[model samples]
Target: MSNPNEVKSTLKPAYDHVIVGGGVAADKAARAIREEAPDASVLIISDVSDGPLYRPGLSKDLWLKADATLEGIDLGTTETGAELLLGTTVTALDPEAHAVTTSDGQQVGYGRLLLATGAAARHIDTPDDDRIVYYRNADDYRHLRSLVSEGIRVAIVGGGYIASEIAAGLAAAGADVSVHFPDSRLLEQMFPDSITSHLAEVYESKGISLNSGFFLSSIHAGRRLTLESRSGEKVEADVVVLGLGAVPNVQLAEEAGLEMEQGGVSVDETLATSAPDVYAAGDIATFSDPILGRRRVEHMANAERSGDAAGRTMAGTRTEYRYTPLFWSDLFDDGYEALGETRTNHRIEEVWNDAHDAAVLYYLDGDVVRGVLMWNTWGAVPKAREVMQASKEGRLKVSELAGQITPGG
Candidate 1:
């Protein structure tokens, strides 16, 4: 536990590097900074009560366990001797002075600053109630777990990966789960109608209710909440969980007068923001991607890689962040690893296995392969990345890549 009074009294004049967020990106950046500049003083400040942990596990592995304590989830100590100031919020940033003001009214200067502020769960217009949860951190998981019981009705909002994973986990925990989303199918943004239908069937077989194209109209909170949809349909549940997706935490960057693009802090290929001596990474950074142009990646892999690159650059090693991100999610017996952009707008070429239980989908923009989706298949991430790169470089045609990727391969 950190004491605000003590931290303010003993604060140093300045540090070599200061990271503004305590998520995976900050953790990796601290380590990379230590490796590059051993003598540099590093300080990590975050509003999270706990230090960096495996955030993705909160929705998946943690919910499935009978006794899911937040143990063994820490990212572990860094060799950088970085001082951690947890449970503290940054109030303001001064780019010209190369300093930041915290909520405690203490200004800390830094030679190089990193804004890995990440994103927060998007809130909806719902009544205030203990049963209403906007799932984001470990605390949210603990609260939801305590409410899960046999036959407990859980109404989930949004049809993204978080809602899907939580629905599956709640069903396994003996809760009657109902998913309500405006999309016609789950993961509608990532998959086409064909893949969405298959995923819907898997959830339906597990006794989970799939209420698609139902926009939430109103919520009447009580011991049991009554939810009314736009279509005049009513559904009652013991608890309501919102997984409506995340909006990047860019207030600090915006206040500091940093450049913005694509709804996030704009950064160059090296993760350097428009402001001098300041960099942004992870969910808050719309970095210049070597392959995809300027884009913001929300997955954990991108966070780690971009943070490492930013740290190295801050430590005087100029390097470009060119790594491709691979995202994965597990739902019951089915799981997938996807490389590149998985948006459904592109033409998708799918190959099903002989058993009809597995599949691989190649996202093509004309004759070029833009992305790859491995359904119920693992360990094909590297191959998928190779195919995407080859297509981008015009070394392989979509037809040639299609024949090479099989369902099992």
Candidate 2:
């Protein structure tokens, strides 16, 4: 699992902290700038020549753990000495000559950079071939785990959360799964229909195939893989996974002008990036969020707490990054845990248990409490972020967040 084309393409013109990306928020911002500037010279460029990855274990435990190992999610880059230029791809971002312009023309330089160019896997116009598998990263989960055998037939498409955890890791490796989606449930903009009708009756009680409202329209990739939809409904398979979600890499922060938002790359609060010495963390960072305010958080706990607060504010320790992270998933046994903006027009509020299999929803908006899931509820994410920081600060009160975290109230 390491040979992403053998990497290490050489580059050392300059670097005190360069970064750009190599996922897991540039390996936790080059191990938090070598633990706060210890001789600091880190580099980490990465366009996936795969050197340090753990991308949510490429959709949960490399397909539901059977002694999972891609060298066990190796995010080591030689334990943070951070050189790694693997497969490069910076392509220009002068940012006032602090420099950066790879893709081979070379022009390194940097004193403090870091963009964490993470995200990109949301296609779906269809027909691309090799039995189409847009499933992001770890080389599409080792090419769909070398095409699982037992009954094969996959056909995923997007029902969110990486196509429901790659249809529970290709139906626990025996394949013959089938998800499709046009939202009739399955994270319909974030659960609730009482947990999306018990998560579509536990993925149709395991045999899978819940084509829900379909609507994909085209994708015929030869030898086996049809998928028509949009009022037609075809769905053959062999392997077709798209999981349409993730777009953030932000074209090198929109060609280096930086400062964008919502669609990400606007920093501040120490993740810096107005340009001076630059910064920006995980999922192209839109950061802010004192309590779910600004956004852009493609999970993995906001890329290791926004790459250790943008590598300790690019190693000088400015570190602020208000951190409102906390994301989790796993579908088969319904593991959950969430935080902030769980959407679906925001007013949620659950708390179930008796066989609905543990819950605690609560999304609210008028009285604050931005979001909190916890389904299959476990240690209660710091008591649901202290009841969403006391409902974002008015001290609870939306009928007291219904049994607050659902203890015995």
Candidate that would win on lDDT? 1
Q: Tens-digit lDDT track for model 1 on 113-209?
A: 9999999999878898989999987668778888889999999988998899999888988999999999899989888776788889999999999
Cα distance off (Å), candidate 1, residue 160: 0.9
Tens-place lDDT per residue, model 2, 1-409, is: 5463254566679888888877777777777778888788888777776776788788888778889888778766666667787777888888888989888788889988888888889775766676687877777777778877789988887888888888888888888888878878877898878778878888888898777788788888777888887787687788888888888888877887878988888888888878898888887788777776788888888888888888987788887988788888878776887888888898887777666668788888787878888877777788888888877778778887667776321
Instruction: For each candidate in the order shown, give its overall lDDT on alpha carbons.
Output: 0.86, 0.80
Q: Poorest 10 consecutive residues of model 1 by lDDT?
A: 1-10
Error of 2 at 72 (Å): 35
Worst 10 residues of 2 by lDDT: 1-10
What's the residue-level lDDT of 161 in candidate 1?
80
- Once fitted onto the true fold, the runs of candidate 1 whose alpha carbons sit more than 4 angstroms away are 1-9, 78-80
lDDT score for candidate 2 against the true structure: 0.80
The residue pairs in collision within model 1 are none
